[model samples]
Target chain A: MKIRGYDKENEEIKLAMTPMIDIVFQLLVFFIMTYKVTTMEGDYNIRMPSAAAEPTLTEETLEDFLEVRLQADPETRFLQTIEVNYGADRQVWNRSAFPVRPAPGEDLTAAQLQQNRDSRKVFASLNQFVINIVGSGSSDPGSGSEIEAEIDADPALRYEDTVYSIEAISGYKDDQKRIVKLIEKIKFRDTTNQSP
Target chain B: MRFRRKRNEILEGDLTPMIDMTFQLIAFFMLVINFSEVELSEEINLPMSELARPPEEAPPFKITLNLKEDGSIKYYDQLIAGIDVIKPILVREIRQANSDGVATSDVVVIIRADMDARTGDVQRLMNKCKAEQLENFSLRVIERLR
Candidate 1:
């Protein structure tokens, strides 16, 4: 309880962390267990389309969400492509079974002819298949991150047909829908990137 | 007798205790310090959106949604086609978190979006949240706290 060299017998002494080693050991274990090794890879540039909508949910209601993909040509206003990004290496994309608008009187498969008769309907059916393909193993319907979307057709593709096409693929009136709550998210890839 | 007493006094105040304290302090800092965080790609220029909010602070169970300049989505740091598939994963992750009793509602979703991201794409992401009823998300921004 005193310094060895000091001649003052009244000198006050203290135990400097005589038991602090235990604290160090405990911290070592804590940090080790708290260590997280996330393997998130890739650096995809996702330019989020902004919105002025009011916020919902809070810091207390963590839930699921969907990542929607729209591949459209602004110049043509066509609903070129659609899909949803679930995770890395997984997707539910729309496949157009239309007969590529082939020249008149060309032989086509029954499935192809059926697809052309109802392009929008066919597109919708394909998308439905894509949606059902997911959560199949799950017993719950809400067990999915189902999204609703609105197609803001490009000026060229903004035709009633295009909108019809989009509506066919995604059932909803662009306002009332659940899950992905998708709508026409315009900002497409570089328009200037187009080959003139 | 005085000489013997002086010899006993010399044994007091050994440095072993102070050394132990120093080691403990070092261990504490090393444990709390997040050196792995430095590995995040600096090329990621996360844009700050007015629609963005702060992330949650808890046991660190969070989802990261990386945005591209062209309004595409990058999840788990990889390129995903769209939200159709992303939904199931989010549901599964949240359901799992909820089952573990680890406060799934406070799940900190870090939206790492690009500066040139489109307003529409941003809306789509938020819409995805509405579908699942999940909240407590934050838009990840690059800070100069270093």
Candidate 2:
């Protein structure tokens, strides 16, 4: 019995690299096209129950809370002032008081560019003031957790300013690059337009 | 001058390295690509905060409401006209959450308001959520690292 000789020419089996390469390239292009660079995001948790459902607080408990009032400019809707009331003691930070001062050679436009920086500085001051009152969360964790903050923002104030205020009251980084938390319990004052 | 005879030879270049690099890139993109973009709206410019840090653990249930600069609310891809119109939507979400065995209070309502949006509108949105008995809220902000 003579065995059929194996076909010599059919021995070399080459994979079709063209189709795989094409598909791979297509996938790469798809991913590259859909890729987007997004900045890191975070959240500030707040618990606000309805007025009807809210538990009645005693006068002593109310006194323990901090009231933050954010006043806005009527026309421009810019933050005009921030006021923090801790019982009878009150602290106010005025935007106009901290005017943006440019360098000697800087022009108006250049100085105006530092407006945001000035706002940040104002918020930083707020953080400092809050630290003085509640003591740094790192130094005294009990006080920070016990004290709640009630944010009463103007109707027309920019949300950004409100966030900055919250950030100021929330925490601050220390010299050691550690986050020193302040007040964690934050609630918004109900300001729904009663009329219209 | 003698003409050289043409030979039928298949020339191949080594594609192993190129294929390897392509696969690596694909893997990286797959790992890094965020599938939660549906909950975030590009139209809203989030406020920056140094104290804001991403939560250590994601909430069991979340309702993301994107407040545009014009006071309009964006729920997923749908553009809500105003804050008042969002009550029904909240009701629907709460009902859905209830069906999923999640309590109304346990559901986290994430407010992603634009930096320029009015504070009053944000409060109103919060109030509306409160009226629905959904108290938990998370205000989304950009994490500013100094």
**Candidates, DockQ:** 0.06, 0.78
TM-score of each: 0.32, 0.89
Model 1 C-alpha lDDT per residue in residues B1-146, reported as the tens digit of each score: 67987777647557677666667666666766676464244445563222112323243466666656555566654676764457876787788778777675456555565544543454456557545655544445432121
Look at candidate 1 and tell me the lDDT of residue B57: 28
For residues A47-133, write the lDDT of model 2, one tens digit per residue: 887777777888978866889999998877878888889878898988863334457996657457577567667788788877877
DockQ of 2: 0.78
Compared with the true structure, model 1 gives a TM-score of 0.32
Of candidate 1 chain B, the 10-residue stretch with the lowest lDDT total is B48-57
TM-score of 2: 0.89
Identify the leading candidate in terms of lDDT: 2
Worst 10 residues of 1 chain A by lDDT: A41-50
The lDDT of each candidate is: 0.46, 0.84
Steric clash count of candidate 1 = 45
